[model samples]
Target: MTEFDAATAIGEGGTAELSDGWVIGEAVNGGILMSLATRAAAEALGAAGSHTDPVAFSTTFLAAAQPGPARVESQILRTGRSFSTAEVTISQGETATLRHTATFADLDANSEPVHLQEAPPELPDPESCAPAARGGFAEKIRILDRLDMRIDPATVGWAVGQPANDGEMRAWIRFADGREPDVLSLPFFLDALPPVTFTFGALGWAPTIAFSGHVRSRPAPGWLRMRITTRNVIGGLFEEDAVIWDSRDRVVAQSRQLAGVRMPSAPVSP
Candidate 1:
């Protein structure tokens, strides 16, 4: 099995383990947690082949999920000839980690004409971009080590106390374990980067409260380039948006998230 599959595999009784390799700070990455729940959702819906792709999902991080065994409970909500939906939840013992509602459909069969006003960001090749800045808050996110990540140096000013204050970031990423990104991994990749708020001078723990995303197409093998931009910051809360593009330049996914953040003056969360 691929690293992602193993990290998110569901066992008997809908049991699964959150791997430390995907850890960010003291908890498993929220995206990985969503993956576990989505996998279970797909299973509960008996999704397979072209019909197995989780086309869209909206999840709420109820509590921090530590690395270890967890259980996924999937309740099928609807099943039709074209799509299936499920409500999935992950729990570690008595604590609820997250709840995800997802819809599965056949991406291969969606041949409708594409009309997109959003364009892909023009970024330097992964080989030319700088590797993930290694210091300060960025260094502490362990999941960065599990992926081959390269950031545009221009957006990394926040890493060195000279943030551009633009609330934007662009980067290239792919699994370090050689796992090619597929439809199921799009949501994980959408949340893979550091909070874009870093570019606007807020550089501490930014725990996501809600995340919603859609997988537009299956990704092609190779590095995926992504752009993240903040929508607005209202007091201590902010909303961020992200878009991912495959190696072939196809729009793979898009996401929006709302998280509570520690603006620059506050100490990092423990």
Candidate 2:
């Protein structure tokens, strides 16, 4: 098992080069790229004397990133006594790949807990579900090798040319290396699953336009259960909402993204 390292050395003028490993299809995974940018932003905030975790992160994808080296440029937007905001841009040479803005703050650990939302979607035990198929698609996307995913069999009809009546997917996911998840891993896991459009009988890639995630709390050590749903797909565009529940069944993070739905194309030869 290989562990994912999101480390970056603080460079002059808020610059750092991202390490390669995570990739999907012809591009690096969006979640991993977002994590890189977030790390650079966090480092910038710490340098400015602000120590806080990212509470809200929003990103807009300008272009797809390829494996190998990329540079991240971070700019501090504002720093308050309790919160800080920063923007990070990742570029490969002259081409800009991703831009992200994040807000950071120290959450109050002693705050009283309030419960209002209903329980997460019920699914069969992780052990009972089938592992995600890792054939042509997985081979093209090398990042699947780094994840341990057990998806609900019912949600996988699309894989066999059957469309799901409802656009919903459920899976239990964790790092293949078994590392405990943290705030930094939250965004990566949030976007780790396949696009919800697949369940709706939409083939081909659904490239994300913009994505945002809110980190509510760090996950406990164990598999992260995820439920992804799409309420609409129209005009070659769609919206996906993802909810992540920790081992303790607590909602740890929430994410939503807008993506362009491309029509299914002929299979590519490896």
Give each model's whole-structure lDDT: 0.85, 0.81
lDDT of 2 by residue, 198-237 (tens): 8766767778999999887667888889999987766778
Model 2 ranges with Cα > 4 A deviation: 6-20, 108-112, 263-270
C-alpha TM-scores of all predictions? 0.93, 0.90
Q: For residues 164-254, could you state the per-residue lDDT of candidate 1 as single tens digits? A: 8777999999998899998878878999998998887777779999999998887899999999998677778989899998887888899
Least well predicted 10-residue stretch by lDDT in candidate 2: 261-270
| Predicted model with the maximum TM-score | 1
TM-score of 1: 0.93
**What is the lDDT for 214 in model 1?**
90
lDDT, candidate 1, equals: 0.85
